[model samples]
Target: MSETTPQNPVFPHPAATLILLRDGPDGLEVLVMERHAGLRFAPGATVFPGGRLEAADHHPLWRAHWPEGEPPADLAHRVAALRECVEECGLLPTCAPLSSAVLADLRRGLAAGEGFAAALARVGVAPALDRMTVLARWITPEMLPRRFDTLFFLVMAPRGQEPVCDGGEAVGVLWATPRRLLAEEESGRRRLVFATRMTLLRLAGCADMAAALACAAVPGQGLPAPILPRLVETAAGPVFRIPAGCGFLPLETSAQTVRLG
Candidate 1:
């Protein structure tokens, strides 16, 4: 951790993304939440399941459950990610809510308030981390006062499951397609952050839910250098573009595969 890494008064907290996917009655769709807009940072923006790392996220009990290979350097990041997903979308991919007896035991340990880590252990429920795959990472520009180093994860929800919003932070929760969302962005119907736009473009290339989830799981092990900004002139006005080639490909569906051109 560098001096620049977010600390106590961290201006830019580490964040995570939960891309919820399911084969809905209409077709394949992704879960999205609309922000309340009263607070700072991404206010009123439509986003995926995600939020900042909370202190409870780093409990030692949960640490024991890490999947094989190397554990993430920041466990808080992971806990925040999973917690945010549940809090925001209620699309938890676990074995439903635990039975009453199991829930009691876990809640007691969790009452110790060990945070997401130790509590996860005490509860005896190891989150199926294997089901989650890192899809992309994004850092808000330094120019912004509120910044974040965010990791996006993709998880497939089983059939018949629906995403429910907590109704606090988010005003609307719905399943939408990338292409449809993009069109919404073009019209006055919706708004998207840069990262959301990028992710949607990548998904647009995927034929269906299964294919999209499969593509999301393809892993790469390099930490990308932070992207720099550039100026681009569009007919509407001026649009900025950032360089691609992170762990995941930056894709745009043009007449070709994407509009990365």
Candidate 2:
């Protein structure tokens, strides 16, 4: 038997998402990654930076370096967040890189196709998982062929670090206003998963990056994996409905099927 979720093993993989934010010409904007074609999941989609946790990400030395408080057994999820950020965009939050050597080494590793996990191991600088605030948890419903226990995290763009699209995995990366991005998605200029759209809508309601980051800083009340169901619509395409008591706003659109909490 697989050693996934003993409690609910059917949904095996655990992942993470990064809600990168910064000030833009217009106003506060969020960094979105345009997923590459080679990805097994969400290919060609505009998504938050993230991926599935890897076994190498859980190295004892790496986990030990995370910020205070015992790391949840889910440290890999945090690693995935960092890895995805680095892979999709050339941004990383390293301490004032001691010298040019630090950056040189980082570039070399990245050039050699070494993801964040590898670069981190080479530099002995483990990810600061404590910096991540789990904003929400989502579980792919059984109806979907693929499922994930994904934890969403929010982080501010670190000083001296600017986000750039990798050209390989991500075609374009931009700090966009939530509403503008929504309009673009609606116009079919951008592609997004139902979850990403809902998350953006919720983030759109927040006043500032500080407030948005604050939500994850405290890891909202608590998260129960949202299991969204798919339902066909008459005028709209397909959409999912949230349970009566779920705090999430209900969405009834034909474009995407989603159930959020």
Tens digit of per-residue lDDT, candidate 1, span 1-261: 111222343355677888877665555678888988785767777888788876556666555666676666545555677777655655455544444455445444433554555555556666655566666667774445667777787777634445566677878898888778878977867877777877887887776778777775345454324443333444444444456554344322221211111
How well does candidate 1 match the true structure in TM-score terms?
Answer: 0.73
Residue pairs that clash (backbone atoms under 3 angstroms), model 2 = 237-254
On residues 197-216, what C-alpha lDDT tens digit does candidate 2 reach at each position? 87788777767787677654
Which consecutive 10 residues in model 2 have the weakest lDDT in total? 1-10
Give per-model TM-scores: 0.73, 0.78
Q: What is the Cα-based TM-score of model 2?
A: 0.78
- Model 2 segments beyond 4 Å from truth? 1-12, 37-40, 95-104, 110-118, 124-126, 217-224, 230-238, 244-247, 251-261
Extract clashing residue pairs from model 1. 56-115, 56-116, 59-118, 61-118, 62-117, 252-258, 252-259, 253-258
Candidate lDDT (C-alpha), each:
0.63, 0.67
